[model samples]
Target chain A: MIRRFIRLLLLAALVAAGFAFWMTRAVPLDEDALAGVEGDVENGQRVFTAAGCASCHAAPDTKGDDKLVLAGGQKFPSNFGTFIAPNISPDPTEGIGDWTAAEFASAVMQGVSPEGQHYYPAFPYGAYTKMKKQDLADLWAYMQTLPASDTASQPHDVGFPFNIRRALGGWKLLFMDDNWVLKNAPSEQVTRGRYLVEALAHCGECHTPRNMLGGMDTSRWLAGAPNPSGKGRIPGIAPGAFKWTEGEITYYLETGFTPDFDSVGGHMVAVVENMAELTEGDRQAIAAYLKSVPEQPSE
Target chain B: MKNIVTATVIAGVLAGSAALAQNDGSAQVKARQGQMRVIALNLGVLGGMAQGKIDYDAEAAQNAADSLAGVAMIHQPTLWIEGTSNADREGTKALPAIWEDNADFMTKWDAFVTAANDMQSAAGTGKDALGPAMGGLGDACKACHEKYQQSDD
Candidate 1:
């Protein structure tokens, strides 16, 4: 009888180990290796502005929303619960002060945080992952120049299953694509804009609706979704809502106007305001890239 | 008949003065209307700042809080005397709920005033009091926006 009991315990242990292996294996990453990439911090700052990193990460009490001190407290509410934006500031105690460039790159590109936990898609790292290696390096360098703030990172108020970080491994496996940029594009300008919009800006985090599993349904990219803040529907950029022309879209990015002579309303007002601060050429490129994308309504 | 005519003339003058007091185009009416507009615009600015989701400056934020409080105190009597129609005339974001759910709105507005007053008082003291003052003011602003202001974004 004792022998049989031992056998059962051993079998249970084996099963648990198998499950753990399966879960971690689903979201693979290079643990021992990181590719070297050189970048220019000055140029990266421009890219950061174009990407609108500060719009969500930095609290507004300081400077313009485009300013990037990254002491995050912005709350994004969804069916899963509120995901409070994390402090990306360089404070050793409160932010990513201790993180290495490789770790940071992995978080941006692979959705893997320093402690090896899989981050939820809410971070939009799936889109960020597509960024060029050198651009990622540049952003990392630029982040280093920020003042080290000791603002405590807030815990997300997510529900039970989602609160479990392990579950995110599976989610990433199914939806997170490491290759974010489409290479060898027809036009350099279009490709550059796509790199900024998809991989860096991660615009789809708010604009794209989610599947039942809470992953972005690529089929409906930028088609619009419910506002994460519980306000109202976030209108799509597709031809249906405003039917924005290329010139109009580019002009709106530069000056915040629609074809109907209406300025941006609601959350988009802030987004447009940030976009307006970008270089005119960069704004035009973003518009060009958006226009080039295949039109598909996110259902 | 002569005595009746004298009484009728006196009544007509009194009625005309009263009508002038409430005329839409009167200076007094326009001034009050302008004050309400200023208050609404101030509240809108505060809300816009909050929605921008940036870090708040202690001094600038306190000033805004103090201004709102002062306006609320000055406007309180005017609101009560002029009633809901005055609120409507000002294009105030003040929802019908402000009058319909009178008790709740009043309670919230009073809380806001008190918080704003505390913030102003705290500013005179030192930076030590700034944090609490800002917190109180932010809470008041959020409470009202949650119920009153229409969602913009």
Candidate 2:
């Protein structure tokens, strides 16, 4: 009986050791061609808007020009706990000023921090992982021009098991590949739309359903889920989630009306506010991408 | 003796407003809901122009904004006479919080009036000015919905 107990303890130890090893692995960006390119500040600003980085990182309830500060105090609530947005300001001590371009690219695309730690997916790096390297460089250049804020990033208020950043490695292992969410594209427009929706726009961060572990279920991508806000449904915009045609979807992005003539309501109202600002082609690309996504039966 | 009389009068007024429910808010529910739909229509026009989704037609925007202002001005005090929640009615997405906190609900309505008035003036100026004004008005509508309306989720 004592020998059996000892063997059980050893097995448990081995399992724990394996998980630790898996969780600490660093995944860096592998694009070799991006190394020598210089980033453009003008295009970087465009990337900033497309990525919607300010919405999460800016101070909560900030309006108008204040969004440019990027001091990072927005709080996002989740089943695990609350996540406070970290400072992405240009301040040397509190922000990313000291980060190398490669570090920024890796953090933004590969979800690896400067210290080689995994950033929380709340940063939406899963979608960013598919971002083009040039865009990343431009975004980095744009960040350089923003005013450096003195505000510090706050610690996340998560539960014990969820709080362990290392554990995120396992979640990353399951969901962190950099391939396009839609592998086969029918057209260049569809491909552009995919890049916008999957990478820069990061629409799936809210729209897609998650598995038990909180990694997005790409199979049901954009099929809609309960509002992360915990109030209403986030309405699936994926194929078959609603019966909207490409034109209707485009019209809605432009005018905020659905087929039933329901005006934009809920959290989507804010999203439309952003999409409305994008160029007409950008909005059309998003519409095209939404139409092309493989259909899933209503969840 | 004089002080006590004034205090009693004040308390009486407060109690009267608190007990102001004269109906179950049934007959007026559809009218009120229809008012909400019209408001959304006006908002769509202004919002489309403001977001640059549609070309800025100053006249069209002004018309939409004016319609919004007109709708916001019509206060059916009797229509809000308590008990008009989704629980009691079939079409509403309104929560009982609207009736329970009538004073707060009216405050939100007042905000809508103020925002609509601002948008009414701003819409005539063209896109750049109207955009922020429309955003302010959208927030006003959203604030009420967040507190008073039931979400579809």
Candidate 3:
């Protein structure tokens, strides 16, 4: 009876081990590495602007020139928990200075760290996964030009089970997709705008609705979301409710005024400020892309 | 005739409440809250004009801007008396930080007054000019919100 009990215990241990192994498995990063892509610093700067990296990674309360310091201590409070942006500056000790372009690509595109750990979706890599390899390379190169700092990133305040990084693999299985939310682009300008909006700018990360587990519900893509911080709804830009013409939309982005004359408010103040810095062509392109996206009527 | 009596009674009640603020903090809290609501209503009118949501009428815009400026100049210290921090969180979004450093919070108040004054000056100049002035006013609101107010909105 003792020998049979010991054998059963061993079998249980083996099963638990297997489950742990399967759950902790990471999505492969070797694929789509930006090794072959040659980065241009000029284009890289544009990529950085489009990505809005400074808004997240820059030191808290920084203004103007100081924003170039990517020390990374901003706290993002959401329904899940508070997620802190890590230092992505060129600091050898504090930031991703030691990382290669391929490693950067893996983190940006696949949401996998160099050590094979999965990043929290708070980093918005789900939308970032749609970024083209060349664009990501340019972005990585541009990031290398920014000033670095030694400030340490705070660990996320996630609750139990959710805190376990391994659990994210299962979440990724359900929600992670690298393809554009919409296909069959009718024009090159629209395609460029799509890349900027869906992948680089990651507008959907804030604008799209989230499911029970906080995954982007692509079925009602860009239909608008309630502010995760619990105030106002983000507003539906879906075709059904969005009455602005392409010119009006572009003007709003550039000047923070709707066709109705409503000035931008809430957290969107920052988004509009960043958009205003982009070129007129880029602004128009973003407007075009927004208009082209398939609209799903929202609540 | 009715307006005169009502105004007198209201003035008397407000004076009584102001005297009792040291003992009953809720009166001051109510006063400050009421002031804020009036400010919001005025801002909404200006916002309507600026957004082109409502057609721009210079007279209405100037009136709204004047009201906002007047409200910003209210004796905030009297309305924000002692014992009305997060301790009395009911029906208020005023954070404890506002009281913790009175001087810094007052700067935000001053900024609001300045922005409102600018808006008042530009309100009658045409809708195009009002946009930037309105933006300045919004920025002042945001500045105060970021530092003193809770992130409810």
Candidate 4:
């Protein structure tokens, strides 16, 4: 009876180990999706601006024209850990210059690096996963044109189990959804707005609250979260709570001026700078889309 | 009777001085805040015209611009005492960076002054002229706030 009991316990442990391995497997984008794709530098520039790549990837406090430099090393403190931005410049030694288009797409869209490791969600690949393949290609082309920085990427300061990159695969499996929060966008403008908000701009990365596992709680999309800095809340921009007209929202994005004449504040100052680079119509679309989001009070 | 009257006068003077000393930091903060509200009030009028929310009245536009320029020209250093930062007080959004980075703060102030002066010149010309002037003014306000002000929201 003792021997039989020990055999059953060993069998259960083996099954559990196998389940963990299967769940933690890296899933990259299909190579066929990237085949024959050509990148246009002009459109790439647009995609780059919309993604606000330089906002985080650039060196902190980079001003004016130097804002274009993708030297990285900006420290982003979060509940999980402090993520040090990687140097994504075209430097072969320190940046992604050696990465192929397929490798880049997999990293951006699937959160799987070329070496088959899962990246922490702090990089916000969950939102980028919704991005169009063409846009990703264009972004790659545009990135290649920018000047490269030789700055080495720093390791994140996450502790214990959070430091284990393999565990992030399970985290991604549970949370990395590419589905549109707004399933039925009413118009072409609204549709474009959805793409911008969901895919390109990643406004939800901050606005949407996360679960205990640090994945976005999609049920409360755009309902805002506690400012990770523990100082204040990142306010929700959902229609019910935000209450700004489409025109007012567009103007705010373009000029950072509210209806009350107060200027934009905090991290939004950089967001507005990026939004200003977009076309007037694009800003209008963002406003319209924001107006369409389902209402949820920012807790 | 004269000695009693002098004693009362001295007591009153001391009480007044004590009150002044106690409220100095907060008073300075409130005064600067009041000046900011004055700026906001004038900007609202100009902004309405620029956005076509309100009809462009040259007189109203000119008046608002002049008021904004006047506030911008204020050089009251006492209104930013060291202990009045948000870190040290309640219900204030003034960050300590204001004192630490005073040179940058002054530079931003200079920019706002320039923008306000430009608005004073351009406001009465036409609504078309008001928009560009407001842009420069808004940018200057934002530049300063981004650095030294804690976000209210």
Q: Please, what are the lDDT tens digits per residue for candidate 3 over residues A106-187?
A: 8887788988999999887887888777778788878888887888777888888689888788888889988888787778
For residue B118, model 4's alpha carbon misses the true position, in angstroms, by 1.7
Which residue ranges in model 4 land beyond 4 Å of their true spot?
B1-24
Candidate 4 is scored at a TM of 0.93
- TM-score for all predictions? 0.63, 0.76, 0.74, 0.93
Q: Estimate, for each residue in B1-153, the C-alpha lDDT of model 4 and write its tens digit.
A: 999999999999999998987775877888889998898889899998998999999999999999998998788576877788888988788888899988888898899999999999999999999889989988898888877888746
Highest TM-score: give the candidate number: 4
- Each candidate's interface RMSD: 8.8, 4.0, 5.3, 1.4
- Candidate 3 at A6: error in angstroms? 15
Candidate 4 local Cα displacement, residue A115, angstroms: 2.6
lDDT of 2 at A237: 81
> What is every candidate's C-alpha DockQ against the true complex, given to 2 decimals?
0.06, 0.20, 0.12, 0.61
For B1-153, candidate 3 gives per-residue lDDT tens digits of 999999999999999987886576777778877777777777767776766767999899889888888897888888777668755646666777788889988997898789989998999889887778877876676666655655422
- Evaluated on chain B only, candidate 2 has a TM-score of 0.79
lDDT ranking, high to low: 4, 2, 3, 1
DockQ, computed on Cα atoms, for candidate 1: 0.06
The local lDDT score (0 to 100) that residue B27 gets in candidate 2 is 60
Question: Which of candidates 1 and 2 reaches a greater DockQ?
Answer: 2
Q: Better model by TM-score, 1 or 2?
A: 2
